[model samples]
Target chain A: MDKRILVIEDEEIIAEYYKKILQNAGYEVAIFYNGNDALQYYRQFHCPVVVTDLEMPQMSGEEVIGNIKEIDDDQVIVVVTSYYDPATIINIMKKNVYDYIVKPIEPVEFGATIKRAFESAEYRKMKKALEQERILKLERQIEWFNWHESIIQRNYDRVDRELFSNLHESFNQGAGFGSLLTLIRLIASMAKKSNGNYVIDEQMFELIKKNADVAEKILNIFSELVIIMNRTFEFEKVSVMELHSLLRMIIAEIEKYAGIKKMKIALSEQKPPYKSAYVNIESDYIKKAFHEIFMNALKFSKPSTAVMVFVDMKTEGVEILIINTPEIIREGVVGIPVEYENLLFEPFFRIAKVVYEEFETSDYGLGLTLVEKIVRKHGGSISIANILDSSDISRASETKVCVRVWLPLASEASRGERKGA
Target chain B: MDFKKAAESMQLPLDDYLSLVQKFLERLPQYREGIFSAKNSGDMKRLAAEAHKLKGVALNLRFEELAECAKKIEIIAKGEAQIADDVFGMLEHLIMEIKQLMLAKENRDG
Candidate 1:
């Protein structure tokens, strides 16, 4: 299409003169005798080139130039004027006008300037088209990557399940040894009760019954452990999570244990009208991570101490800090050692055995290990440390352990990205 | 009032040049009112701009004497020259000549 040129001049004859020359050059030309009409014309039709006088009634040509730029900064404009002020010319040039023409304009020179302006307009259009093409190519590449990632994730999950199955089988085979020993003990008690006799006494019968019950409980514990150990995680269903609700769900899972120790779970107040702190994560995996962390905090907290949980909304993410002081480090010990922080998330890693012995608990499970795995899978992080207040250090009994988790926020754009992932 | 000469310079027929001259005459009253208003209000910038516009129109229409007068007035009103009264008088005289030309054509046409 022939490029459109807009001419703005309040002097009727000069405007007509420009219109005639531009029309004769086989260019589409529109003329306005005032700045108002010229600006209106540009707004509606978006002329590629403009020839404007510096001074006009209603609105000045400079204002017209500025307003046109606001609509579309790529417009090519040439300022034509009889005004011989150098300052005024320099000022208009600063506005990025394409060319300046002094009146009475030589027709050849004016036409040449218009041709150059058209070349600039064509360049801008071509550059914009190339930029749009690049964006489309990038979007296509992202789509392909997302598809490839999903396939890889699917295979990884299959391999993970198979590996867990093998591990569980080995564990079950190891538990058979414990089962055999219990049987031998029961058999020994039975043989003694049957010493030269055909019937068992009441006390002997009670002994046999008690041993059977212990065996049953041991088997149940092993089966439950296998179930938890063999659990698999998938990040396919990422969504905006209501962190408060998720946290409450985790707390509820361990509420019975908390009650046994008389440990109150105090949730720090969330900001505002209780709107959910939405985090971008796989909902189930993140929930499982929080549940494990909460369990660990409850298990180690001193009896009757509240497990303090604070959920704060940060600019980049949601920060959840779970703190328990006077926690069980090891039997007589109260605080976790600094070196243990790094090893806390290793699979099957546990605190000192003396802690379990003192508490009379058999399990020091992979809670933190699983929590770290799930957090890292969601592109977030978890940390554990011992924070000592002045009073905590002064008093030998105080041990403050903090478990901090940072989960990135689920912004609208991130949600779109997550869908692709 | 050499209408044929003016038309020849513009490469137009005499009737076309007369039409343009008539249009210029029709706007003369408004131009006169604007010049007087600017002078009475001491608005030198407006006066200069108005005179500059008149200069452009006169030059395009082949009115050489009037264009020269308007250019002088424009220079004076813009404070580039110190001949405001003399330039104003010349501008008025040139405007009267155009008005007389318009009257002569109207009488001849009638």
Candidate 2:
């Protein structure tokens, strides 16, 4: 919305004339008597339209145009000169001058030309903005597609492994189909012996029912697992929430869990501007991702040490860092190595034994993996790295683990909508 | 000087045109001095440059006769033609005439 017009004319009377006319036309005007001064001013404040006289003292209009074009090729320049030679006109045209005004210009026509120049400037600004937006959208789409492909591949691998292991264990342990067959045989034999008299004991009946339930439960769980693995997720249920509010809610919930280990959960205080930074996310899923990461941090943290959470607004998005000091490094219980830090997101990858007895289940090692998957689904990424103490010059031991998560900010359109609401 | 015609060509009100004429008259002495000094020194390039500057301002103010005289001086100097004494004389005459007219308007207005 810059409506300033720069006039570079050596003739004081003519420069004044242009100022009066342009000002009357509702434009803010800055007049320079020489090209050098004008160029200095232009460098500071880029006016939308530049009206420069060709014959000036220090620098000629052609030189001014060349310098301005070098600075910004999209600059709009209009030449004003008394000499109307065809060669000079062609030269100016080759330099990409927008239009030329001869001496003793018609006020109305000059006004019209300047109006067109301003229109061209506006169009160029809009086009540049749209091009940047298009590139960002394409980049996001490419990232989403890449993440989607990896998730699908990982799902297949997990399902295949789980199916083979479950089927093998069922056949070996006789806890599923084998137990059901044994119970069926015992019931048949009891019924045959009864022979119109009730001879089956209540304990025997209860045992048969319990085995049948176990077999059914196993089959049902397998089917459910397959369905979950192949399910297509819909991501339309997103809301724009401030980063501070989301972190506060998660931290409040995890604070209780940290209390049992006599550990403290500390959240870094964010400034007002950064605290209000909004991110578009499914609140429930993002909470789960953060919860898993926080749990991991608390689990590996030395007892009674503080788990520090820092939320920072990065250029591309919001970054949350959870830093926790590990317990004393013992043999086979050291911090994750720097080179293998990325493996933290791989399924079934465990660096050490589970410290918390509550999470001792089949899904024990998949916490960070599931966290990474959920983060990636929301167009985010999670990474873990070991933090070496600055004082430790040898760099032999890592003191802490830092779990970093980056999530994209809410889109401008969504922010506008939120503002309206 | 045809004040109405000049004002109309410049697309300005008579009062605004008169004030612009005053500014031009103020700078006329400097332009005249630059031209004669360059001619005396036989610096054709400087003479042509000074004349060109005067011609551009004269044309903008619709001083057709003055502009024509300045343009002739610029061409003759740039072409390395013989320094005709009458060309300088004619330019002086035009500048004096415009200066007198602008001064008269100022007196009448005051």
Candidate 3:
């Protein structure tokens, strides 16, 4: 196969050298010095293998690498660095870098490394393409299921929307959007996950023309989720004193990406009765949730008004208050909550009236399930109700969602505290 | 284990470990940085730790005489023990031995 490759090395000499070697080996090569410019063509000119040096002047190899690989994990990146150390190893492994070449380069070794990188990249592209093809094939089977179910529903005069929805929704998620809709979604996601490249052999190229590149669209959803997933986490044991400091760290990381709307996070327990109950939570999840909400608040709210985090020891346990300065109405929450959507924790479910354009990605966990299970493990309750605080919810479609997390606290400690009080 | 065999396994030059004083003289800045930085950083007191590592490497590489000198620096840096004159002398002596080894290799290779 005549493979296409992209090289983003700053040195003209090195770039020329690589281009010659790759071209000689029958690969069509493209080179760029700038990171952002290279990134612009990332999807447009999807290459299987990418070679970059550690310190590029403008974006740094690390930044360009973070951007590109997040778009597709399978993109083979061989890092060329002068310094080989344990610290370097830890940082490099985080992005799942394919391999590294330590400098004072050997010409033979360099050539060999690039060959290996191409093989790795090709392997990933082939794997994702095959998985996508399998998913699409499953969808076709589910489409047959959808057809049968739809015909059955047409014959029955009375059918509830939820029940009717369930008939297809169950298999849609299981097989992904019932052949037609979500199979396309998964294919597009898989394409994005594969760095927007596809196996464009004569057969696939023909099929893609009819398919409308649903792979790109489907991949967009997952890409957005990935962007959310990659947000920062200073995963430290945060005491109540460190809440402001934690927020500062969170703000520092995200400030480059999103503007803060008025978020004032304060530890509300002013007295000595403060409890340090630390749960091993992924800070990435917490940051993602807050960033989405803060972005929404910034986009929707009146500027200069303060959005706040008010924490209190509620009956359930520690209640975290994300005080939204309301301008936009929440969407999709009405009547009874749907089971699957509840698990996604997405804004669409929280507010029924929310426009699709306005929705942002949310967190997931078997943790939510397990917490309730463990609460049941130790006999605890879980519930939610919105307090009518002075700063309005009048314009909102649903009440402000203050998620009250009821962790099972130590009863002996509680009783002792109560006696002391 | 034979000190020479241990030195060989560790990939350290024998003569370098033998003349400890000269080696210390040559690596004074590095030794100072690694040792004192470890003291201040509250991380692993790694300079002395690294010296110990070098000692083992030197011993395994059959540079036993120099390894003995490295042990002095290692003990002083790592062990929270005093650096006696004899140990310091061994370090200088090992450094000189290492120079001689390098000089010999150069003469043959050249």
**Leading candidate by TM-score:** 2
Scored by DockQ, the top model is 2
The native-contact fraction of candidate 1 is 0.20
For residues A1-421, write the lDDT of model 3, one tens digit per residue: 2267788876544455556556766788889877888888876767777877675667888998999888876777888765557698678867788888765344567778887776555445433543454465477878756864676557444334434443334334322224446444545555433466553346434554433343344445456555444443233343433443444565455443333443333223232333454322334444444455444434444445434444445443444444433443435532222233233232212222222232222211112332333223323343332323321122233223333334333343343232110
Model 2 lDDT per residue over A46-110, tens place: 88789998988789899999999998788888888777788888889899888888775778889
Ranking by TM-score: 2, 1, 3
Badly placed stretches (over 4 Å) of model 1 are A142-421, B1-19, B99-110
Q: Candidate 3 at A11: error in angstroms?
A: 1.6
- Clash count, candidate 1: 0
Docking class of 2: acceptable
Candidate 1 lDDT, A149-192, residue by residue in tens: 66556666654554465344423332333444555566566654
Cα error of candidate 2 at position B34, Å = 1.0
CA lDDT of B54 in candidate 3? Answer: 47
Q: Provide the fnat value for model 2, as a fraction from 0 to 1.
A: 0.68
